[model samples]
Each structure stands twice: as structure tokens, then as C-alpha cells.
Target chain A: MRAAAQVFDEYGLAGSSISKIMTRAGTTQGAMYFHFKSKENLARAVINEQAADLSLPERPEGLAQLIGLTFFLAREMQSNVLFRAGVTLAVEQGQVGLRDFSPYDMWADLFRGELEAARSKGELQDDVDVAEVAQLLVAAYTGSQVMSNLLTGPDRADLPERIGRMWRYVLPGIAQPDRLAELREVAERTGPAA
Target chain B: MRAAAQVFDEYGLAGSSISKIMTRAGTTQGAMYFHFKSKENLARAVINEQAADLSLPERPEGLAQLIGLTFFLAREMQSNVLFRAGVTLAVEQGQVGLRDFSPYDMWADLFRGELEAARSKGELQDDVDVAEVAQLLVAAYTGSQVMSNLLTGPDRADLPERIGRMWRYVLPGIAQPDRLAELREVAERTGPAA
Candidate 1:
């Protein structure tokens, strides 16, 4: 799986091959077939397990935690090969003739859950639709990563900063008036360390 | 070019073949090579001409015009096959082993020009970073379009609405205090017709 992730990350789904992954893994074709059955299955597994290594520090489940989660993800995209590979595959899945949107859907649901918690705690504005905001965040983050990766290279060195800027721009429109300042601060301060 | 766009849009760069494009275009391979020596060259041409069909109304060149441009793009993404194909190729260029960042850079420059005008007119907040906001807007718009296409299908039925929501969410963070409401109103009102 690790080898597959590395291969997919560098070459993308259409460019990756089972033979290349097998060579990288130092495994026989028969063993590879026994494990993954097909390259598509292996790719899907990578996508599903993209977040398996995420170790976010436990934070209260609300807006702050959500902000922390994004910061953590931005950091991960910079250094984590597996996670970055999964994101690349997901974005380029159309080229692979795969329409799997589960990764995007899962992120949207997770963000929605956080926003719902924020709403319950009066951290969100009354007019803020939790689902819409959640979806927007996911899309915005996805785009930010892509742009950062394209402009800043595969390391995505500036993704964390871009994400911080994104939160600063978005929070005032959705966070409760009195909580906006605090939320912006949280977005700024919550990073890999937090 | 139209045939090439359709083929590239549907099959992407790696999946598309010169013969296939020729078949679709009803042209000889010799003729095709006369215009484009390689698939990569053709893909780049498509990306460069992505906005060739855009005919946005002449609006004062500032934030409102920028907002109108995004709205127009949202609507175009739904119906313009050539435009959609160019975007898909640009995003999926990695699959074709192409690293052209010109398209994205062009967009950022276009957006930055409008934002700079907005700043000169005091439509933006004093603390706003024009270049950063322009880059953020481009990234946000790209992500919104990808998500809308993914969730709402290839037709991207809700793309215009998503773009509108994006503007509403982002404007509050950078627009001048008094201009916020008017800017948002412009965002809401500026659409396909305008």
C-alpha cells in the first residue's frame, strides 16, 4: 500500500501501473493480485485510508477543532506522501474513469458535523447554513491545496498559510458576530503544534 | 480545435489519441499535425483559449466586474464544452506529464488587476491584501467548480449558485465596511445577463 501510494502520488492513476507498484513493493505479481486484486482496488484502498495517519491533538468538537483540523490537514499535505497521493488520485479520478466522490463527501460530512456543533454552541451565525458552509469549506480547501501544490510545488509548502488566509476570509461571513474575532484567532494559532 | 477539445474533455490527455481526435474532427492525420505537432501542444492551446468564447458585458473594471466575470464563468462551465474541456485538461495535465502553470497564472493576474482597481477605488478594506485575495478567489472558484461538477454532475446545475454563495462568504472579509452590503448586492445581482 505504501509503495502504491508513492507510485500513484508521483505518476497519478492513469500513469501508474501494477507492475511499477509491484516493483516498488518488491513483491511478486501473484502476491500483489492476492492482496489487492486490481490496481483500481488498490487505488480505492489508498483513497479510503488517506486519513489513517492523521493524529490531531484532541480539541473540543466545534469551530475551533474544525479550524485545527484544516490546519493539520494542510500540514499533512506538505509532508505525508500517502495523504497527498490520495488527494491527487481523488482529484484526477476522472482521468482514471473513476467517479468515486466518497473522499469529498466524507470531508463535507465531517465539516458539517463540526459546524452543527458550532451552531449548537452559538458559535455560528443564525443565517449560516451548516451544510452549505461545510461544503464550501471542503471545496475551498481542495482548491487551495491544488493551487498551492501547483504554484508552490508538490511539497505544498505554503498550503498552511493559504488555509489560514482562507479561514480569515471566510469566518467573518459565517461566525457569530461576537465570536468572529476569537474564531479568527483560533484559525491563526491552531496549526501543526496545536 | 472543437473536436480536440471534446476528445480531450472526455478522455483527458493520456486517454486521448491523435487518431481519435482526427476521427472526431473528420480531418486527416496530416492536416492535424500541420496545426498541432503533439498532443501536449494541442492541450496547451485549448487551455490558452479557454476563455476565447467569453463575451461578458462591459462593466466598470473593479470588484463588481470581477464578481460578474465569475458569475459568467459559472454559467459557461455548465454549457461550454470547449471551456469545460480546457479546464479539465488543465487540472488533469499532470496525468499527461505536463507542468504548464500559465493558465492558472493568467487567471490570477486577471483577478489581481481587478482587485487592484478595487483597492484604488477604496472598495476593499484597508487591511486587505489585493494579491492574496485575488489568488484566494481563483483557488476558491476553482475548488467550487470542481465540487459542484462532482456533486451536481457534469452539467454543474448549481455552479452559479455555488459561485454566488462563495462571493457572499468571501466578500465580508475584504470589502470596505460600507461597501460590504453594496458589494454583496452586486455579487447577487451580477449574473449571466449582466
Candidate 2:
């Protein structure tokens, strides 16, 4: 799985081949076939397990936790190859004709849960729709990472800062007026410093 | 060019072959080679000319015009195959190891210019940074379309509405309080019926 992730990361799904991955993994074809039937299956496994390495320390659930989650992802994207490869494959999956949207759906649900908690605690505005905002956050985060990859390189060095800027622009529209300043401060802080 | 756009759109850069493009174009290899020496060159042409067909009618330059431009793009992404093809290739270019960022840079600059105009007209708050907002807009718009494509499909039927939602969430962070309601109304409206 790790070797496949590396190959998929560097060459993308369409550009990656079983032979290349097998060579990189130093495994025989028969053994590789025994474990995974096809390249697509390997790719899917990588996509499904993308969040395995994304460990966030325990924190209160609400808008601040949501902000912290995004920050953690931004930092992970820079440092974790397997996680980064999964993201790269997800974005490039269309090229290989793979349309599995489970990752996106899973993320939206996770964010919606966070937003719902925020609303329950009076951190969110009364009229804010948690589901729609959750979907939008997923989309915005996806695009921000892609743009960072293109403009800043594969390392995505500026993603954390970019996400911070995103929160500053988005928080005012959803969060309660009283929580705005503190939430914006939370959004601006980089890494797991909290 | 149209045939190449269609082929690139469906197959992406890596999966697309010179022979497939030649067959799609219904032209001799010599003729195709005469215009574009390589597949990379053809892909570059498509990327560079992605916005050639994005025509916006006469509108006052400010926040409204910026909003109008995004709407126009959303509508185009639905009906215009060539335009959609260009966008698909741009997003999928990294799969083929092509990292040309001129398309993204062009978009950021174009958005930044509109934002500068908006700031000058007092449509934006005094503390807002036009350049950062402009880049964020580009990133958000890019992500929104990708998510729409993934969740909604290639036609992107919901993109205009989604972009409208984005503006609603973002405007409050930068726009003057007096302009919020009017801009939010403008953002919610679909199509080019101004």
C-alpha cells in the first residue's frame, strides 16, 4: 500500500502502472496479484485509507475544532506522503475514469457534524444551513489545496496560511457576531500550537 | 482545436494520445503536426486559450461585475463543451506532469483587477486586502467547480448556484455593510439576465 501510494503520488493513476508499482515495491507479480487484484483496487484502497494518518489531538467540538481540523490537514498535506498521495489521486482520479466520491461524502458529513455542534452551542448563526456549508467547505478546501499545489509546488507550503485566509473570509457569514473575533484568531493561528 | 479540446476534456492529458486527437480531428497527421508539433504543445494551446470564449456583456466595473463574471463562467461551464474541456485539462494537467500555472495566474490577476476597482468604489471595507481576496476567490471558485463536477457531474448544473452561495459567505468579510444586502441579492440571482 505504501509503495502504491508513492507511485500514484509521483505519476498519478493514469500515469502509474502495475509494473512500476511492483518494481517500486520490490514484490513479485504473483504476490502482488494475490494481495490486490488490480491497479484500480490499489488506488481505491489508498483513497479509502487517506485519513488513517490524520491524527488530531482531542479538542472541543464546534467552529474552533473545525478550524483546527483544517489547519491540521494543511500541515499534514505538507509532511505526509501517503496522505498527500491520496489527495493527489482523488483530484486526478477523473483522468483514470474513476468516479468514487466516498471521500468527499465522508468529509462533508464530518464537517456537517461539526457545524451542527456549532449551531447547537450558539456559535453559528440561526439561519446557517450546516449541510450546505459543510459541502462548500469541502469544495473550498479541495480547491485551496489544488491552487496551493500549483502555485507553491507539490509541498503546498502556503496551504495553512491560505486556509487561514479562507476562514477569515468565510467566518463572518456564518459565525455569531460575538464569536467572530476569537474564531478569526483561532483561524489565523498555524499548526497545533493550541 | 475543437477536436483536441474534446479529446483532452474526456481523456485528460496523459490518457489522450496524438493518434486519438488526430482521428477525432479527422485530419491527416501531417496537418495536425504542422499546427502543433507535440501533444504538450496542443495541451498548452488549449490551456492558454481556455478563457477565449468567456464573454461578459457590458456591466459596470465593481463588485457586481466580478460577481457577474463568475456567473457567466458558471453558465458557460454548463453549455460550452470547448470551455469545459479547457477547464478539465487545466485541472488534470498535473496528472501528465505538466505544471503550467499561467492559467491560474491569469485568473488571479483578472479577479484582482476587479477587486481593486471594487475597493476604489468603496464596495469593499477599508481593511480588506484586495490581492489576497482575489487569490482566495480564484482558489474558491476553482474548488467549487471541481466539487460541483464531482458531486453534480461534468455538466456542473449547480455551479452557478454554488458560486452564488460562495459569494454570500465571503462578501460579509470584505464588502461594506451598506452593500451587503444588494450584493447578496445579486449573488443569488442566476443567469446573465441583467
Candidate 3:
């Protein structure tokens, strides 16, 4: 999987091939297929695997943390080209061309769960329009990776901070006015979204 | 040039060699070189050529139109996979990454220009952040395209309405309370988010 991540980092999801995956993994096609059914299936497993690493506790903090956590998780995954390429390519396919739910539907499910949970906890606006907010955040963060990765290449120092700022900056507009106050309270308690 | 667009679309930026371009354009490399100095210059010219066809007015009402124009141009160039390829390659090479500045940038530039003009016209709040707002719009709209494109594939219908609703829904937040009246007045006279 790490090898797969490396290959994806170099060529991208739309650009990856089974042969390359096999060669880089130091395994044969049969060995690779034994663990995963198809290319798309393998890609999905890799994506969900990373999502697993990104999951957080049900108990939460301010709106910024909730939002920033999501963005940070995404930026962190940027280092894993496997996950990054999968989500980005999925985003490009799903948002621009058609309703691509094949792989992303699962990611969206997890994301939606987190978002709705936040809303119910008063971490989000009551009328926050969960669907639209999720859509925008996903787009912004994903687009950020695309733009920044392409323009600045993949350097992490600026990414998490920039990603955090993007969430902080945009969250105010989408969340209830009081949510900002909640963010400060939470940040003071925990250093994450600070 | 249209033939060149077709060739680049089919083969992608790096994939399409000079021989392929000449073959598709039905001209020898000699004739092609006469017009474009190098592959980069030729790619640059193709960008300019394709850009003119996708250009839109710099009006606020035209923002959504501009967004729509880019998606349409991209879709038209969809079969031409090289649409963002050369541009990304250029950016990777430390250029503006504006190689032929995808219609998206023009949309962003137009959004910035009209927004600043609106601010100048006192149609916006003096405290309003023009660049941030513009960046937000660019991120959202372009982000939507990325999401729909990479995730779902080629969804066009949902795009226009989605973007329209997006621009309309967010306009109020970016405008000052005093300018709210002008915005409503403008939106009614021109269009939502005008």
C-alpha cells in the first residue's frame, strides 16, 4: 500500500496502472489481485483506509475544529498520493462531470455523518444546509489541494496552516454567528484548531 | 488551431508529440513552426486561440455566465484531455500556470475586476475583502467543477443551477448591510448575485 501510495504520488489516480502497481509493490499481478479485486476496488480500499486514520471522537469542539479537522485530515492525506489522488479524481469526476458516487459515496457518507453530528451538537448552524456546506467544504479543500499541489508542489508546512485558515475563514459565513465564539472556547481548551 | 485543440484533447499535452499535432492539423512541422516557435509557444497560442472562443463579459451578472462558460469550454475540451494538462505542466515548470489560462481564471479575473469595480462604485462595503471574496468564489465555482468532473464525470445541467444558487446564496454575506440594498437592486435589475 505504501508503494501504491508512492506510485500514485508520482502519476496520479487517473494516471495509475495495474502493471505499475504490481511492479512497485514488489509483487506479481496475482499477488496484488489476491488482496484486491480490481483497480477501482483497490483504490477504494486505499481511500477508506486513510479515512479510517482520519476519524475522530463523537465528542467535539468548536465549529472551526470540526471543519478544520476535516480540512486537516484532507491535507494530511495529501502526503499519501494514493488517498489524495483517489479523492481528488473522484471529486473531479463526481462534481464536474456527473454524480459520481461509486467510490466517493462512501467517503461522502463518512463526511456527512461528521457534518450532521456537528450540526446536531450546535457546532454548526441549525439552518446550516448540511448538504450544501459539505459540498462547498469538500470542493474548497479538494480544490486547494489541486491548486496548491500544482502551484506550490507538495510541501506540508504551509498546507495544514493554510487549510486550517481556509476552514476558519469560510466557516464563519456558513455557521451560526455564535459558532465562532464556540470555536474560541474549544480552541482554548484544546490546541488543535487554535 | 481547432484541429490542434482536437489533437491535444485526444492525446493530452505531454502525450501529443509535434508529429501527432502536425498530422492532425494536416500541416507539416515546418508550417506549424512558422506560426509557433516551440511546443510551449504553440501550446501557448492554442490557449489564446481557445480562450477567445470561451470569453465572457466582465459584468457581475456575467459571473455565473462566466462560470458556466468555463464549464462549457471544459466540456467541449473534455474530449481534449489536454485542456488543463499544458497549463499544469507550465505551472509545474514555474510559470503562471496560466498557460492558456483556463476559462476559469478569466472567470476569476472577471469576478475580481467587477467586484473591485463594484467596491469602487460603493456597491460594496468599504470593509469588504475583495480578494478573499473573489478567491472564495473562484474556489467554490472551480471547486464545484472539480468535484463534479473528477467524481461523477460530466454533469452539466446540475452545474449551472448549482453554481447559480451558490453565487446567489453567498452574495449577501460578502456585501455590506448598506450595500445590501444595492445588491438586491442590482440582482433584481441584472440577476441574482449581481
The RMSD of every model to the true structure, in order and in angstroms, is 2.2, 2.2, 5.7
Error of 3 at A20 (Å): 4.8
Query: What's the number of clashes in each of the models?
Result: 0, 0, 33
Per residue, candidate 3 scores C-alpha lDDT tens digits across B54-77 of: 445545543333344434544533
Cα lDDT tens digits, model 2, B44-86, are 7888888877775444388988998888888889878778888
DockQ score, prediction 1: 0.69
Model 1: clashing residue pairs? none
Reference-based lDDT, each prediction: 0.83, 0.83, 0.53
The DockQ score of candidate 2 comes to: 0.70
What is the C-alpha lDDT profile of model 3 across A3-51, one tens digit per residue? 6656655665546677888888889877888887665665555555545
Chain A vs. true chain A, TM-score per model, equals 0.93, 0.92, 0.68
Q: Residue A17 of model 1: what lDDT?
A: 93
Task: Give per-residue CA lDDT, model 1, range B1-194, as digits (tens).
Answer: 88989898777676898889999999998899999998888888888899788775443378988998888888888889889988877787777677777888877888888888888898888888878887788888888878777777778888888888888788888888798888888887885334
> Residue B17 CA error for candidate 3 (Å)?
6.8
Per-model TM values vs. the true structure: 0.93, 0.94, 0.70
- Worst-scoring 10-residue span by lDDT in model 3 chain B: B90-99
Q: Ten residues in a row with the worst lDDT in model 1 chain B?
A: B52-61
Please list the residue runs of candidate 1 whose C-alpha ends up more than 4 Å from where it truly belongs after superposition: A56-60, A191-194, B56-60, B191-194
lDDT score for candidate 2 against the true structure: 0.83
Off by over 4 Å in 2: A56-60, A191-194, B57-60, B191-194
Model 1 lDDT at residue B58 = 46
